[model samples]
Target: MSLHDTADDAEPRGPRGIQSIEVGGQLLLALAHHGRPLPLKDLAREAGMVPAKAHPYLVSFQKVGLVAQDAGSGHYGLGPLALQMGLIGLQQYDPLRLATPLIEELAEALGLTVALAMWGNRGPTIVRVAEAATPVHVTMRHGTVMSLRDTASGRLFAALLPPERLREALGAGLDELATDAPFQQALSEIRAGQPARAEGDAVPGIHALAVPVFDSLGRLVLGLTVVGPGAAIDLGPQGAVARRMQQAAQALSQQLGWRGSA
Candidate 1:
């Protein structure tokens, strides 16, 4: 038989799905990518379908609360149902559970120790670690509370938190250091999305770079850090290691429903 006939008769390799629903899903994907309301024609073009073919699908979506149109502008966007569904999914996500496997993959791929740190009651605390095949000799472990004034992960959390929260976290000491020129400059750079680094300060001959992960509401969720021997880790802002770490952090943030730029 011909290719089409053969494919029709072939055994299914995975669970079957409704072809029409799958096609409709394309429109939703397109809307999500644009991240703004779109005219019918534009949305259809983005979804690779003609407007006439897309209209019925959009109508069905609207009825189900998956899509909405602005009355005045006649532009389509995600509806209330979509927002509720997204919020529910975000609430179900566990940052540590997701970060664990990702950091493991990164550690193996980059041959550098990777860690996930969340702000604890005391400070930025290391909650998970993925040791490299040849682990460095740095004194890092789960439950290690990083120094707010010294470590890369610590500085990352310090920079990302709002001023009020920072003051609460550090109390009177932060007020004292806020006037320090170098401290202000470092936090300024980090707040602008640059990764923080520590060279032989946290641990002699050990170096680290840390990038911030944010939640859906743009809150600082955690810090993803790479650690290694001083000579092996590149802590420069635009270096290869820094780029990879930042990319990983951004990807993780997106997974957590963050739509903002890193």
Candidate 2:
């Protein structure tokens, strides 16, 4: 499906095979995938090249502001130019458009319903759902405003969203059965990187696990939740399905120019 892999006639090639560009790409990939600044030696090692060869490329990248070295610590990370490129990529890119394919794949792979939600005019709304082959009796659908305290998708925003947005969501979909102290404690735990969970809280006999997606500015953009019958879904964040769900969310986050760790 890659654009570069389409069928084409064989063409003449250079002897060195565009070595410098290839090396530059490898180094950039290393920096991006690592998600943090790296020392010169470590960056070189990650790209499978010695410092002697990598340094020259780094210097060229630095000149163009694609990479920047810390003068004191001697570490290097993505510079302004690299961030500009990422920002430009996201300019016309829609996260949902980028994530729908991933959601469908996860639903098929896990045999469950994958829901994508975002903060809407009224509250956290289910914007899309990708369901597996098996029939599910749940009534959730597009435009449904999730319960701020009952739905896993809603709680994901409560955990990491800004206070103003949280207030708006609460006004729109607060759960009557929710107790304030317990809600605060649960939000604290969820904010500590736990996937939000709700069983018989959103839908009777239904359970869900929600993983968060954040933008480059560290703002919550959407939640990816997997839903199924309580007995069929793995509610734990550590389980196989949850891990795969997290991976999919991470992929979408990256498309939005989010580099998870500083």
| Candidate with the greatest TM-score versus the true structure | 1
Candidate 1 TM-score to native: 0.92
Model 2 misplacement above 4 A: 1-17, 30-43, 62-65, 68-80, 169-179
Q: State the lDDT of candidate 1 residue by residue for 1-262, as single tens digits.
A: 8999899889567887899999999999999998999999999999999999999999999999999999999999999999899889999998888889999999998999999999887788999999999988776799999988788998888888876776766789887877878767878899887899888887888999999988988999889999999888878899999998988889989999999885
Top candidate (lDDT): 1
Task: Give each model a TM-score.
Answer: 0.92, 0.79
> 190 in model 2: Cα distance from truth in Å?
1.1
Residue clash pairs of candidate 1: none
Candidate 2 lDDT over 109-220, as tens digits, reads 9999998999987778999999977857686789988887888887888788877776664663344424578777778878888888888886789898999987877788
Q: What is the Cα-based TM-score of model 2?
A: 0.79
